[model samples]
Target: MSTLGMVDLQVNGFGGIDFNKDDLTAEELDHALTAMLATGVTRCLPTIITAHTECLRARLRALDSAICNSRLGPVMIDGIHIEGPFLSAKDGYAGCHPKDAMRLPSIENFDYLTEGLRTPIAMMTLAPEHDGSTQFIRELISRGTTVSLGHTRATRDQILQAIEAGATMSTHLGNGIAHMLEKNNNPLFAQLGEDRLIAGLIADGVHVPPYMLQSWIRAKQASRVALVTDATAAAAARPGTYTLGDVTIERGTDGIVREPGSPYLAGSGVTLDQCVRNIMNWHGYDLATTFCMARNTPLSVLGKSAIPSVGDIAECVFWQQHDAQWHVTGARIGNWQVHINS
Candidate 1:
């Protein structure tokens, strides 16, 4: 069997690096990319959460330079995933993002936030219930940007409308919600039933329970499910307190990251490599099927080729399962060959 390189579409920060911060240097960005590479993520989109306008611009510019300068190499930073400032302002739905920064979805504001950046914005996560969001989704799709519905309180009708308007994915389904929800009428069920939307799941076993994860996979099927880590700065860092944007979060020994003194999760501490293992263990999937969910599904949704054509020498990762755990023992990216167990 041929190996497949993993791709992560929704990652905020990793290896003690926060992409939303204003002072993020190129060196720190390089370090974060290297950490991701170690975990078998050959391609990724660095996600930026909700923040002030100027702050967002600064961060975007810094990231643009980091990619253009070859700080992490040519193919590591495939694109950028802008997650907020256009999301719902509801309490639990907003998660740890600054409530004051939330805004109605608009292309003008998006243009302002991403001004003068040469890096392509691959996807944007927003609340589709907001006025003009449907049109905004169409506009983004026109410009070759994928729109994902998330951080929302949309009705079932609104979700369908977003899908009709070219929203093709969901950011971290089963998350960005309050502990309590209306039993039947909710975004979770609405998204699950929509076959057009490719759902992103964080299978760290903490974000979404095993039963719910199994249900989502069954509902959406493996082909339409993309596994993402949604990892924060705490990932690959020591287990302790760390900052995600402006919020302080603590990573416990259990490997779950949460807001200080609260049960609400800040983000994930697990890497994508760990997510693959968890999903396989939870669902009893074969290694090939698991890799397709993590790699092919996301690449297809992002309008990228899922695999190398016949006679092409594509970069890939070789994995070995031991004691019910999956490990990336080697990887080849273009001319680069990385050996993990040598």
Candidate 2:
């Protein structure tokens, strides 16, 4: 059946190409986009998590150059998702992000990181409880950037304040936190209760359990939920060790990516299409509804429109389900049509 082309707003890497690197090349970026397209993702925002200031700058420059030089341009690489350097420095909550690189949120720092970059900074993931984060979130919203709260130890009140200050979403709502938290009060529950905020959930099954995923969807409602891969370079690659930012993570035979000898997840090794299938099987959602959560919800949060009802030139994907897996058979991305070999 045909579905609206998927949009991934928080992809770090795929097809063995890590976007969170200082040495990312234009060709490698093109190959990554190709890999994503082969899996039915028509557009995406490449996410860069916590890193050194200069490193982030260099990476942003490289991505901007790649987008400018790419044949796909905006159709493939729509924007950038800056995930950190402004997250919680607390243990467990920080995940695999380098603590030394973490910093308090500031508009000046954001400006320095994004300076001279043509690619739009579509979204940012930051801890709301950090000093100056409220103003920074407001400023980012004013400048047309979508701000998301994540990697945080913020209290319920703090989250509400961030939402009041213009934070519109939660980045990977259930991940990026410690193993233990108080049952009633936590970032996850706080975000789930906020009707004004949309939540991005990594439905790769490894990031969140099926029951928990179902609970999150029920709390946030299907319309307020968006599926994200939160994928790392190990995604679509063979099981082995991979690097994200400077941390070494092992993708075991079970397909779970995590820090060596630690239970902390590094990132997901699943594609967005697989995430869609997992969500469908876990939640018993139909193809159209699942596509809405995978595609339209994210576009809505970014202030973009959904697919046209009566357009021949619409971006779309042709896929079929077999053995509980969704496979892309063909796709029309922008003006281009891609056919996959069976």
Candidate 3:
């Protein structure tokens, strides 16, 4: 079945627009949203990565204004995902975020940005190894936000502690940290081994291979997996140089390619639609499973209250199969069908 709507839970930025950039006006976000919709993403969590506290606070405030005021043209702001500032300091697997400001566990810092949001935060990524990390997880859980593990070097026991403390998710499982203790003792295996926790996968083939995605889906069945763009300013932007936080990301033809000197993927350039495409084409997964990974699973991540509905600030898009490809047919906001293609 070709589903009509889709949801993307972890998108950092799009069309040269970063959620963490203070200069990224509402108009730029609108442009990004428009591009996302064209690719079949109806709802999304615009993620903000770990950086300077002031920069993080400013981004949160800007997003709050845009969502409350509806300042971004035709785009809908579903919520936000604060990726980090508190994570492991390890070089390779911790990814390409700024190292200086990164801390382990700081509840005071978590409260700073969450308190500033006008809309709810869909999720937050934190490492369990930091001091008071468990307490921070519980606090975030009580506030109705999903806590995800990421950019961490936590041991298996530590991950279990975080999960028990209310951290029931993982952010881009295989992309975060590269070096890990062998066997099932690291975050990747720890997250994959648990049936209760949900993990977001890139599914772009570049970030994760087909066999791994297949194995993950088979291991967790259909209910525990979700797709994330992890997109940067280069998501829909043409191949060129763009910025993520304070770093420079150069986009290439095969999608956003990281420099040779980089450790992990610099930042994702994949889109929600492309992720769906890969699951179907690369891994040969069924359409229903792809839709679930791209939509329903993420909805589950938002908890039960904020789930999609006809009268509750609904956002969705429709597509129908046309020959060998899927073509966008319609888009809606609440009850209004705002855009229609063919």
* lDDT by residue (tens digit), candidate 2, 274-314: 88888888889987888898889999989888756565346
Residue-level lDDT tens digits of model 1 in 1-342: 237689999888999887777777778887887788778888899998998889888888887887777656456777899999889899879988899999898888899989898999999999999999989999999999999988888889999999999999999998997678788888888998899999999999888999989988999999999999999999988889988878888998888899978888998899988989988888999888988988999999899888678865467787877786778887766665677773
Worst 10 residues of 2 by lDDT: 306-315
Name the 10 consecutive residues with the lowest summed lDDT in model 3.
Answer: 69-78
How do the residues 166-233 of candidate 3 rate in per-residue lDDT, one tens digit apiece?
88778888877765467767777888888778988888787788888889878877678888878888
Error of 3 at 80 (Å): 1.4
Worst 10-residue lDDT window for candidate 1 reads 66-75
- For each candidate in turn, the TM-score is 0.95, 0.95, 0.91
Q: Best to worst by lDDT, what's the order?
A: 1, 2, 3
lDDT, model 3, position 139: 85
Q: What lDDT does candidate 3 reach at residue 32?
A: 79
If both were scored by lDDT, which would come out higher, candidate 1 or candidate 3? 1
Residue 69 lDDT in model 1? 74
TM-score of 1: 0.95
